[model samples]
Target: MAVPRRVVIVGAGLAGASAAGALRERGFDGEILLFGRERHRPYELPALSKEILLGNADEPAWVHDENAYADRDIRLHSATAVERVSLAGHSVLDSEGEEHRYDRLLLATGSHPRALRVPGSDLRGLHLLRTLDDSLALRTALRQAERVVVVGAGWIGCEVAAAARSHGAATTVVDPLPLPLRGSLGDEMGEVFRAVHAEQGVDWRLATAVAGFTGEDQLTGVVLTDGTEIPADMAVVGVGAAPRLGLAEQAGLILTNEVPGGGVAVDSTLRTSDPDVFAAGDIAAPDHPVHGRIRVEHWANAKDQGAHVAGNLLDAGQPYRAEPYFFTDQYELGMEYRGLADPRHDELVVRGDLGAREFIAFWLREGRVQAAMNVNWWDDGDALQALVDRHAEVDARQLRSGDLASLVP
Candidate 1:
């Protein structure tokens, strides 16, 4: 048999580290080198804004230490980054002007948070939360500010608002959309989130767009599109993040189109146009088995996609297919969602009580189960997935009666 190829992975986040770990698990004796731009160990990002921000969890996010990598015989390089990629000859150039050659390369650079384009967005008190540094900076600024205005109704936006409220800061969430999580959970559930934050004493401003900033040096207030001025002590912008795809684009890789958000494109195998190069995490826009070519940014997606990339790199024989799955934790509430909703589905079945903070809603498209939302009752996730895969349709009564196991295929 031919010798195993060298594997070099970029971005040291969940995707990069998990990919390297999976490779060793699959008995790949090849030389594996993992590069991380950050000068620390790889840790989970989901807890950054929640547990880490609220001071509830203190353990490091890294699942393993340096000794683990050494034991596996994998090279883990920290405080280093791949400045550019020379696809013509499989290799990457680091920030120190050093070159490393590899037979297979995995790009998981992830993404950077999208910033506010307003004039005072660069003010000292203004902040964006995406990295550990951003979290620490925002945490400090929020403690000092008395009144805080948060822009955007996205997951991060709502989570930050909750965090700010926990710290006794007068908090307000302003979003152009009517509901905070309308993009992922649908408008109906979006209203649930709006009510949740409102009940917790957070100011929720819906269907309102920010016009401009009101300060010259530091953020003093904000201007709405209709000329409504709301004074603030500080501001946090959590709109979203733009995929870091400069290297991929420069390498002439095939770009995929994201309908609502602009993101990169890749095939089912997580491969760009260049066969040897693969991508995962936020930077990749692969065709979803159900959601078409859209990009979903969740911690689970990164871990799963990274595993797929690693499996495929072992040999040309194994190909990986991803099933979209994710979950969110806030306010002592756990919300789990599976599969993608079909745009054709207009009818929804509410099996449980949504108002009671415990319910399951299933989206149907052409008589097939497309997606589902499980609130509180987390045990039925596997049953829902099986029902979805089999396209089994049962009376809505069984779902509302807490007999979801009976609906399993």
Candidate 2:
């Protein structure tokens, strides 16, 4: 494949910034044009939930300074959204009725928060966290909120609940699952975090769904599906997010990942049905040789794929070879997870004391290490990742008692 003279990218987040950096570092010298819906520069999305919500907005979240993009001759068009991708002429139409031509196209549109659809959901005090503005607004609301009813105990919901509790607000987390993070950590391990939150005065309402909100123009309280009502001044919906693939869908690109808000299907090299069009970040469902077609919403995976896709654009010989990695932070516990293992199917094994909040867990299937997680571990993530990649048979007795570092080989 020859070098493209003009490359158009459809996202202005970390993934887009990282790709533009990679292209310049590799000495591509091409016209890299980036478009984003937000007016702000590319910043970290993970920080919006934690640091920004806690009023610690001083944290550096920008991927790079303006000088970095300017020095590389990259053109960034903020607050301009791409409406559709046309393959016939290799151009994209923007929201302002402008068309931009490109020799190569990349979609890093990322995702958006999934809104709750129930009676009274249109009321005020209902919030969804996705962008910086959403975080800022929610933070201001939490400062004055007396009681917060957090819907869905996923990562965002759990973290936001912790922040509200820190502000002396009575926090009630509602979820239909038996435990929080059950989809990722299974029942037993998920109980660990649940216990911590409970100890911190979080009212856990498991196996329950919200019937609706009760109020005229503002949320006065939340009514549960079982006819139980929880008083609240505000509610945060963190059920999950869906990929922003409207442009791809309109362009008739192949769609996969059956779940709502899934991703665009692509080959291992990140090429879509149209060879000139590619995808990266949360919007890409690249076919992994080991895990098949899966869309991972982890920050690390998106950043890595962004850089790798740039190389594929220059030379289409190499496939995306990195595995999935993710992390979560709540209260005193910090977790780093590696590999792709279904929590329901994998046999769970623990290595340290849950009481001390310091330990590592392994997800083994047929005696082969499929995935591993470290709680409160800062420097041991790479080792756990190695243990997962080795795919070696495990000795249960050794895994439970021996040092986790020894399992890497």
TM-score of each: 0.93, 0.97
Best-performing candidate as measured by TM-score: 2
Each prediction's whole-model lDDT (CA): 0.79, 0.87
For residues 1-111, what per-residue lDDT tens digits would candidate 1 score against the true structure?
A: 243479999888888898999998888989998888887777778877787667676544774676888999889888898888889978889888989898888889888
lDDT of 1 at 127: 85
* Residue 165, candidate 1: alpha-carbon lDDT: 86
Q: Taking the tens digit of each residue's C-alpha lDDT, what string does model 2 give over 1-409?
A: 6678999999988888888888888889879999999988888788888888877774438887868888889998899999888999999998899999998898999998888889999999999998888888899999999999999999999999988988889999999998999998898888999998998999999999999999889899999999999989999999999898888898888988664467899999998988888999989998877777888888898789989999887765478867788787788888888887889998888888878989888889999888888898666676677788787687877788876678667
How does residue 154 of candidate 2 score in lDDT?
92
What is the model-wide C-alpha lDDT for candidate 2?
Answer: 0.87
Task: List per-candidate RMSD values in Å.
Answer: 2.2, 1.4
| Candidate 1: worst-modelled 10 consecutive residues by lDDT | 314-323
| Model 1 lDDT at residue 160 | 88
